[model samples]
Target: MRNRLVAGALCGTLAVAGFTGCGIPERSEVRVDGRRQPATESGAVNAWRKEPPPRSMSGTDPEEFVRNFLSAAAGEPDRAYYRVKQFIAQEDDHRLQEKQGSEVELTVVRLVDKPVITPDIDSTRVTIAVQQVGVLRTDGKLAPPVSTDTRYEFGLRSASPAGSVDDGAGFYVIDPPNVLLLSDVALRDYYESQTIYFWNSERTRLVPDLRYLPLTVPNERRLNEVVKWLVGGPSDWLRPGVVGLPDRTELINNATGGNGRWEVNLDMSGDDRTRADQLLTQIAWSLPEFDGQLELKVRNNSVLTEDLGERRSARALYQGLDAPVRYCVYEGSIHPLGIAGESPGAVPLDPGANRNVVSAGFTRADKQVFAALVTASAGRQRLSVGTGPAPVTTFTKGPEHTAIGRPVWLRATDPHQPQGLVVADGRLYRFDQNARMSQIVLNLPPGSVTAVAASLDGRRIALIAGGALYVAALNLDGGTVAVGPPRRVATSLTSLSAVDWGDEERLIVAGAAGRPAIYEISVDGALQTPLKDDTGARVTHLTAFPTNPATKLPSGAFMYEANNVSYRSSPVERIQREQVLDVTPPPTGVRPGSPSAPFFLF
Candidate 1:
């Protein structure tokens, strides 16, 4: 079906333009032609030349260059089609190309909606909607065009074509046998060649910026291979000031096999340089193998300058580490200084605390060092360590025991008594006082209570148990608890986890369900609109950043275990992906390699 459309379109162009067809040239013959062509005649040759070409021999302008190239390619109809397809494919501008085999057919469809272009003085951007219709023929005639609409923005570098050249300016069609055809190798080669042209062309004229093209060929296997190479290729190297807010970032340590661990560091710096500077120094490492066992560590310099500057400096210790640790130093010493640790558990920090916490994770005996440091820091009132169980003797105050069970979540309440909520044995327990037995406000059925969240005032709690939404209100003054009857939010939901207060009266909840949608629930139990309009893969987690009261845009949010994919909110504008830390370990059988390891160290 797609092939038929492409064939029809190509035949239509040939018939309408009265162009001749050319055969695919042999590789040897093509190479001969390429060699005979002076390097100076090549568009990209000038880009690498240190000296500019003689003004007299600058040759034709960009528009003329394009016309000439098209005309030359047209001499070989098959080659011309291949070149055109090659250029389109390289730019990933194809929305239609699907299957590839002999007699490749490509259907080019214009998008119903055009892109919105914001032009500058010398340059004007024109957005066109197009679909690449691709068809692979196994038998019979090509099928009808199967199109995928995509919008492409082309920047006219030298404004609209003017004077006698105006005919070739804007967009011009190279009469076929000169028009390029659609083919895998042809498109690839064409793009490779054209990229050179765009990069080096001496005359500034209408040329497609290959930089903005997407590699959209339909073959998943081929696409994956191409994408992998492109992402890591020289053409894709991270440029200064080009690192956008990553939707995700990942790091691997001991890639060779120290427990086969990796650390993903996120540049949450946003647009604020100062905030980014502070965030870069404080590294956060998550262990995917161990349920995202997050460890927060401070750079030695950041730590030393604030605490042990007189005895030792960070510059000294940092220089000793085999691998350089990434960090940014702030002007002032670390404020709210402290060292803290937790063993085999998630440590929830106060939202309002200063960003001066230093942490580390250790296996075996080193865990003791972390525990001792945390204990001493807590004793000195320098750090507040949130942990599950501290050995009674380790606590200088003989362990002011709070009967919170395993997987306990603590939130500071009034400083006098921190509130502890425990999910244990399929029941929810609230620990109020030091010696008092924990209160079982709600006894969840077996295999229920997947997640729990409290309102800002701690007066209400939301829980997901047995695939249902359960709300419980604590009557602090009345000394009573009212549990709302469980209500099914979505029957197909496999799991419900992330839940948070969206605002004073609304709760934002997300999870694995019919569709992973961020829902806004009012205090009165009205389900407002969802933040996401499309049904996506199950949402692993949802976190909201503090929103500026002035601007309603979300400041930050955490989306866990997200599938790395792209989506379009509209035809013209595509949301750019922000890089986040990639903490995930490599696949099995892939041996991890370390950045550095001394022969004797391992």
Candidate 2:
């Protein structure tokens, strides 16, 4: 009977304790005084009547569970609160961990499990299963490792006999063996995986600075170096690259040291070669620093070879040698035909298309005359006729007359009354009808007059004396009188070589001082500004070219001699020089009923 009694007590205890699914019985039967109760129908009824219904566990909401889980995973209060506050509400008695002096406060970051409850007739036991998330102060040494799979256990008691809950409380952390606390290795690995990996995911790739790299390093240099190589170097050593362009060629005439001189000879076998050579020569000579001169000579190879032994094609010859004197000969195909002799004392019966004529002795004119003549060094007499086998009029004493030096210019006034000539010595001579001698119209200033240019209407003339500018008027009776006081245009003017009438009111004068510059002056004694500031060399001569009337563009070539080099300038350059002259034609006719009637008339 005792054995039976013990077994009955054990079964009663099992019924009250409730069955655990892990190999435990569903119920236990025990007496009211810890004695075993018989497993009879009556006993079971009494025991069942005494038992109470199961009380619900506190904090069992699924949303709360999930919120707690995520908050703990995130590990920041503000971030967790913002993320999870919408889902769960804490019970009134919920308490956060607080600290004293330097200790950090800890709050419940998350709860991870459902609560379970067991109940009997007189008492109840509650089990709160949760994963607690918390923070500890690290003094910024390193961040605390995240806790994983941590568990919490808690208990709750009923506040009133009515079974309303008084308090739900818990204390928690991960248990020893089952807990995943932050280990040194684990924390480092976790940091590298979770924090660092996530941070670096959004960053851009890195590039390197290569300028300071060692010589053996292979990398792109600075952008500037790359650009310099692509373009030409600063010295412009490389030609720009272009498809189908001609290879760059250089023709250098290097004269090294004081008197070391060399000349480059170019031979052209075809028209293409000649064209190329000419273009290159122009480009080289145009540079301001080249300081070299070029000469082009063309000879017919066919003629030379036919006359000699072999057929000689067109060839270029350059002769260069070190010497005190330098000369460049430019010879073209056309040879100037010369009129052999001056017919002195002979007059045409009808003036016979004699557009140009010369007289050695006294001459006469119907109107005023402006002329430039080269003087004899010893005698005051001016020679207008040459005496030799190849006789030509001798004017300038400077250089001998050559094919290149033959002077051709224009003269105009009234065809009915033509202006005559004025010598450098300021003697006015008129063309006589007999053409044998010049009739002295007037003897004026005996000072050397280097240049004389007449206005379009022949009413005014500009004369240069001792580097001074003088303006004079021609009376209707062919008399000359000074118009204004002698004006000093330039004090250092050493020579006045040429003068051209820019318009009816101003003159363009070229001469040497320190350097050559072209000046414009008004016939009324006004000085306009110089044309170019400095040409860097002396100007020997200047002349205007004929232009097209319709376009007002020069139709022929204007010429200037500078640094012993003659240049055929474009019309644009000539006009730029004209601006220095400051001469403007009046809207009305200045020369009426004259051959150059409307002075600018086409």
Candidate 3:
């Protein structure tokens, strides 16, 4: 029951059309009959377009036909993948019948080399070497490879006399692999990425789980497909920290609506009426494109919630931090970041005389307060918090010069009492508005936390431990900080240096697989999209403004620092190196001229 189009809405005709999932543009559409309709006709109902179904090439070499068959298998999901049978032996065609509903579950692999063909007297053997990429659990959710070793072999023979009677007969595959095989490209072209919403373990907030719905689904059935998947549950990787609808919850009928309005009716007979609000909130957040209402009914024709059966636009029901402003610490002072034009005035935190700042963060509650990690002695550092120009309140100190990570503010709804988190001596601690500090225990090896970033909503925390990425649910129940078991993600990145939330479902991370670069990874680890960063220097730090859902644009700039120089990037501006920031009052006496660690106040 959401009216506003947040993050991902329908493409082209945002208001009239249904959700298209991700921001990627729709592929060219072809009618279901595999032909284009004449543009000269006027009709009451608009014609539909989908990717043309794959067809086998005629009069082609057996090896060539094998290639075509492989390509055809990966195209639009035809009924039982019947389209691929055109190139299979009529006797072996029945093999695919068992593969129904498995088109989206097919294994995706990257071709390591060309297919090797071994010819025999009556048949040819095709051996393909491949590296497993992942598996398509749904249209949008690609589970990580189950094992490191994934290869396949196929057999083909000249068409039988009965098969040759057909038009331009080519060789038919003999015994093909029992499971379906698809290339990485086909996985991308056929599936549309959609995010499903789930509640945190505490049931206090909704977390996004990115899943895919195949583009092959007709517009009329897309809503039902999404709703069914939502009721089924969240992906396995995200299950550790999130909860889905009640067990056995079922859709009573197809989601019905039109003209930009829709309604979903769910059967929640076994569900507790007290939890109806939480269930409805999850549904509202998941279906941002359905700008109408939702109804939950029991089996006996009774409403699930006697007083709260109807739900209208829930856009504001679950919102995270909105548009952020970026700031930089220079020469013991904080200044608003400016790529061009005159820089804004510095925040008057008063870092105290002769104190060298290591890192810092700022937040606004009842009043503006700044936190910093500053050099306490020749080889030691201490964390502090204070208001403008007031005497700084020190929180924790590190022993033996152990480097302290930068301070990050958790979302504090109360204007008077803000909370921030920092890492020192390999232990995580939280600071409350009254400057009370408490350690947040994690189920990991001690001293493994290298860095941490709190999600804008303040319910989730992403951290790097032992050079690996992990995200955990943050439960602030009864004023005591408790962290749920941390779930490891982004395993593809062998080493991680920094991480930050790009949005609810995606994290902007700086890590290395083979080469060093920046990547946007879905929180579930199903998808990893690399951003353009050609800078040879390794990214040691990253600061991002969570994307604004209303405009589908970042509210502020995203800046990162590498090689001691800070660079700025945004939707309006491509990644570009910026000149060294000019310090306010220009530090004297051989100070480091390059600005480092610029961040946005969450």
Candidate 4:
């Protein structure tokens, strides 16, 4: 899809992350095209010499040259590559092109101070350290916002002594050119994020992976690039457990579309014709953003799909897989939300549940809801299971421990019921049917974890610890699994109240530091587009998806408290409902925080 439609297109562009210096990749020949110089009459060898391009920096001042190198390098990948090379010696012309893939557009967020340049022999050791934002790493993960410093080796040459010539007369060059450093705000404006959706063997989930691309492409070229990247397959980190595009296939011509229909022609002679259906399926799942129907052709010959007769949206493969099975509560009750919100989407539960449960969760398998319950207002908290009814089963009763927030349920496809995760007394614990004892998942400093939510795929978890949002890789094996170091979701969001998977890779976040607005932020921190229609009020609670979890429509509903009254509203349609489905408002006096009040779907 085009950058305009990207839900999490953070800022005018998306975000980037950490930066530490690494030597530029080895040099390769720079391709000089015919367009570089204008053509003159064939036989006439004119007496003309090409003028040197304006210098980014002109002088013996090595420090300013370092700054100029960065300014020149922060541009369209190729243009910047060539511009930065002018600062290096002629011998290192290919370093930028060879080291950074030709297609990569660099977004360098500079958070560094003045450089310290020390002259040594013919070489000047220029140490340029910076706190980088929006930095992309080789492993396909965004770096966290932190100051990581490195030095650049820039060799210099001089034509005269200090008093012999003008200050701008001598020479200062960023020696190898490969170790160029840069910093600027506008770098992000030229980049936008694109997503490629892939699925597991069961097709139970569509994993959205993000890729940052330049906005230089036009609509047609953008569409063509999307097709090319989709067929190119997902990033290495997300490659495991997800399907890959068929081998030996490539796009022979361009992809063209009109009136919401797209024509994709591919070269198919290499091999594996048996996987035609899989290839088409991949394309089908990807075209919804364009509001498109695809007509795929192999070598300009149409591949008919009418015979199979089973057409599915990429989303269709993952329906009901991550549906919130039960409504979450902050007070002492559990209500069944089921797969569809229709099972009951309001507050103030009916006569079936216990009154002591403060937080709750349930499985996709059944109505059975599990919760953290306090026997009394002053009693110890314990884990209990019930079917939204009284006389709940006491599963795990621990010491007088303080529960952080609500308990989250992760429903595995296993024969057993859904798994439960809760944080108490600064320790994260998990619960199951046969095991009544608490198994710690991860431990943190007291009050560090502000909020927690997991992706639908169940392999990753999102946390708001230490007042910042982060997505941590999760390994949920019988609890010995580890939680990898976190990648902060947004370097800008310092105060986030809640987070839920908007799609596989994007998250709908509320309470972005100081704003009343909500943002469609990517899990990798690359994109953060504001939800189009304003929430009409300070957004206090958010449900990631629509009432129908299977539906592809982004959720327009949110809960906010105003004028001392809580109301559920859809700012998109400008609809405000005083009552939230069947659930009644808090009984007379008890008021759960908006974060605690919004009904959580499984």
By TM-score, the better pick of 1 and 4 is 4
Please identify model 2 stretches exceeding 4 Å from their true place: 1-417, 424-446, 478-494, 535-537, 545-558, 570-602
lDDT of 2 by residue, 525-552 (tens): 2123244335556665554322211122
Error of 3 at 409 (Å): 3.5
Q: Which ranges in model 1 have alpha carbons more than 4 Å from their true place?
A: 1-412, 431-439, 443-447, 477-497, 533-536, 546-558, 562-602
Stretch of 10 with least lDDT, candidate 4: 29-38
lDDT of 1 at 341: 18
Query: 1-602 in candidate 4: lDDT tens per residue?
Result: 12222332323422211111231211221211111112122222213222223343456666666655555554335455566666665554665544466334443544334677777875667666554455553222344544344334455655345456555654535345344344533333334445556664344455556654444434444456667777777654455445556676688778776544567788765443445555565555443344445577788877743211135443364445442322434334544332222344333233444566655444344444444333335665665543333234444544456554545665433424445555555556665543243755444444566566666665566776666777765544444334655666654443566666655566667664344555666666644555532334455334444222243333323333322233333323211222223356666787633323444454
lDDT of 3 by residue, 329-352 (tens): 555545555544323434444434
- Lowest summed lDDT window (length 10), candidate 2: 193-202
RMSD of each: 26.1, 48.9, 7.7, 12.0
The per-model lDDT (C-alpha) reads 0.27, 0.27, 0.57, 0.48
In model 2, state the lDDT of residue 566.
Answer: 44
lDDT of 1 at 150: 54
TM agreement with the true structure for every prediction: 0.27, 0.26, 0.72, 0.58
**Candidate with more favorable, higher lDDT: 1 or 4:** 4
Q: Candidate 3 or 4, higher TM-score? A: 3
Better of 3 and 4 by lDDT: 3
What clash pairs does model 3 have? 30-50, 140-212, 141-212, 366-415
> What is candidate 2's TM-score against the reference?
0.26
Cα misplacement distance, residue 432 of candidate 3 (Å): 5.2
Question: Which has the greatest lDDT?
Answer: 3
